[model samples]
Each structure stands twice: as structure tokens, then as C-alpha cells.
Target: MPTALDRPTERPADARGRVAELRAVRAQAVAGPSARATEAQHAKGKLTARERIELLVDPGSFHEVEQLRRHRATGFGLEAKRPYTDGVITGWGMVEGRTVFVYAHDFRIFGALRKAYGGAYIVMESQSIGADLTYAWPTNETAVMGAEGAANVTFRRQIANAEDPEAARAHMVKEYKSELMHPYYAAERGLVDDVIDPAGTREVLIKSLAMLRTKHADLPPRKHGNQPQ
Candidate 1:
């Protein structure tokens, strides 16, 4: 999907051209760089984000959204290498005849049964955040940000003052991930409810959704809550 993002920003001249553009981007987003890469995922016993979504929603029911969005982080030689969907495939579809939205960020999330968390991790609905139930795979990591970013923010002085800054940074990043970012770490502390196998995701979701199907939340009756700050 133009990881370098070289596509023309200009809109197509006609509806047909626009439709063609849409199809082209969808193909690129779904198929990725090539078929071989998809096969590599299978070889490693993993499913791509798209495939994982397909595993949950009813057949032919899933519809993707924002398949053309790209990361805006620049200046790591990455500005020219940012791919569309930004490694995330977000959308909605019918799950057991119920409308469900999904925000799949590569190997990280599947809403109620997924992984990881950032500042706005509520977008993926953690149990302590908004979800009724949460499940995670065994290989997930959790932190407000990647370990590198978190370490830099949390251990700024230690890293800067170390005898060997690079080694200190690396060791700290590793420690942060293992200690504070393990998947079960969140579950143990009640941030996450449980950890489930990926293969059983559909069943767990089906049961959980059924239980929460009639659950409803109502805002407290109040006036003038949006007072001047």
C-alpha cells in the first residue's frame, strides 16, 4: 500500500477511476507486499492481522476501515517507508449476528480477546477500561508504549548517566518489557481478565458476547456537567 507513500494525492477524475483506486489499495493492504510474505507467516505458525479478523467474523461479513492510513513518524529513514493501514486493520463486522467493531494492530489486538495497550488503549477495550471480558495470547507484550520509548521516558537519568549508555539503555529496555510488560502481568493485576489461546478466540468471544448481550450502561442524570474548566 505504498509504504513509501508515493501515491498521487490527487483524486481521480471520474467515479470509475476512483473505484479503481479503491480496489488497488484494498488489494495491496490485504495481500501485503507479496504472497511469499503471507506464506512466511503461515510457516512461522502465525496469522496476519487480516487473517486473524477473518477467523472471528462471519464469513463474507467483515468490512475493513482505514486501510490506507499510514504512520506519520519521520526521520528514521521511516518517513519514506511507512505503509498504509499503519500495521493496523480496523473495521467492523457481524459476530454471531451482532454488530462488532475490531481494531487489529498486527499481532497486538483483537478487541475483547487480544493484546497490548497504549495511552488510549481503551480504543481496544481493556477490561479495566471498558470491556466486559478480556483475553490475551501467550506471546503478547503490554505497556503504554514500546519498551524503548518507555525506558527513555522512565529511566532518562539512569540511561544518560550510565558508563555505557547503549548497554544501559538495552538492559533497561529488556527489564521494562519483562517486568512491567508481560502479557500475564496485566491479568495478574486485574488490568486483564484472562489469557486465552488464539485458536479458541471465536468460542470465547461468542460466549462472552452472549453473556454481555443485554448489558447496558446509562449516563448519570445531571445537568451542567460540562462547566467551564
Candidate 2:
């Protein structure tokens, strides 16, 4: 009598066939809105979260992961209206054939406002998986807000008085100041490794991935809720 460890394991007839079956089941059970579906949802205003990711990554090379996980909440009476993925998409795919994790916020559902569990899930995923590069394009509405001062005052005022000459001048000045301040703030906090021009994004991502891949194999296992301060 052979022990279980001593028994020869039989290979499945078709690995691809099994993968397809699993993928189909995942699609039916867990998959949320597609990049296209999310885009259509936000067509009234702008691109969806998925659309932004597509723009950021190299074409035809994204291999998404955990795409099927749906929101588990039911008691708030909001579950019916909420998307399966809680308006957030998570996955890992190749940026120029190098592995990188992504979590794109879909504003279509709840305006990309992170509900209780959804925000935490993505934060944890990002921390644990350790993306080589993360592209967080929070909606323009949020990003445009000034952190402090008279410049912030000017920005808020300009929105309401777009036709006013004084407002327009103030707005331009405020915008320039904000742009200058943001990079400095980010550097101080170490939120970004470095900022790059929009046109250079793909090349930068490719280079970053190449650099990350050179590190020793077997990265440390993911630790939950380890977000950067």
C-alpha cells in the first residue's frame, strides 16, 4: 500500500480547458463591470476608472486578477444599487510584460466614493501586492481642491464666477501655484517615487517594472492594511 505522498499525481488532460472553465465560472459569479461598461456609465461626464487604467497601461497586455469579487454587504439597503466590484476594480497585469498590480476606482458607482469595505480592500491589496508603480488619478473634482490659503480661496471663488475678469485672473494664478505646490508636498510626504510627464508615462512604467523585476525573487508575503502614512 503506497502512502498518499508516494502516489504519482495524474496530470489533467487540458490545462487550458480547465482555465477556460474557471474563467467562465468567475465571469458568471464574480466579474464586475468591464472597462467598456464602466466607461459607458460615466459617458455623461468623463471616462470611467477602467478607462483611465487602459490609458495608463500598455495596450493589449493587462492580465486582471480578482475581477470577480463582489460586495458582500446587504443590510444597508444600498447593495441592490451598488456594483459587484463596489465601484473599484483590482487586478495584476503586464505593463510591457512586467507584473504590476492595479486598483482603479470606478466613479460610475457611487461617484468612486469608497464605501466601508471597498476602500479598505483596495488599500490592502495595493500594500500587500506592492505595485512597481501606481497611478492614482483621483477625479478632477477632488484633485483640483487647494490644500490651503488664499489660492484655495481663489479656486473656489473662480468656479462660481467663471465670467468675472478678476476671478479668471485669480484662477490662473491659483492653478499655477497649486501645480507647483503639489509636487513639493508629494515629495515631502514621499507619496510618489517621482512625477513624470503624461506623454512619458508608458516609458517610465516600463523602466520602473524592469528595475523592480531585477530584485531577488520571492518577495515578502502581503501584509494586510499596511497602507503608506
Model 1 misplacement above 4 A: 1-18, 71-73, 107-123, 144-175, 221-229
The weakest ten consecutive residues by lDDT in model 2 span 136-145
Clashing pairs in 2: 30-68, 31-68
Q: For candidate 1, what is the TM-score?
A: 0.73
In candidate 1, position 80 carries an lDDT of 60
Enumerate residue pairs that collide in model 1: none
lDDT by residue (tens digit), candidate 1, 134-218: 7777777766888898899999999999999999999999999889887788778877778788898888888889999899999
Error of 2 at 94 (Å): 1.7
Each candidate structure's TM-score, on Cα atoms with residue i matched to residue i, is 0.73, 0.48
- C-alpha lDDT of residue 114 in model 2: 30
In the order shown, what is each candidate's alpha-carbon RMSD? Answer: 5.0, 12.4
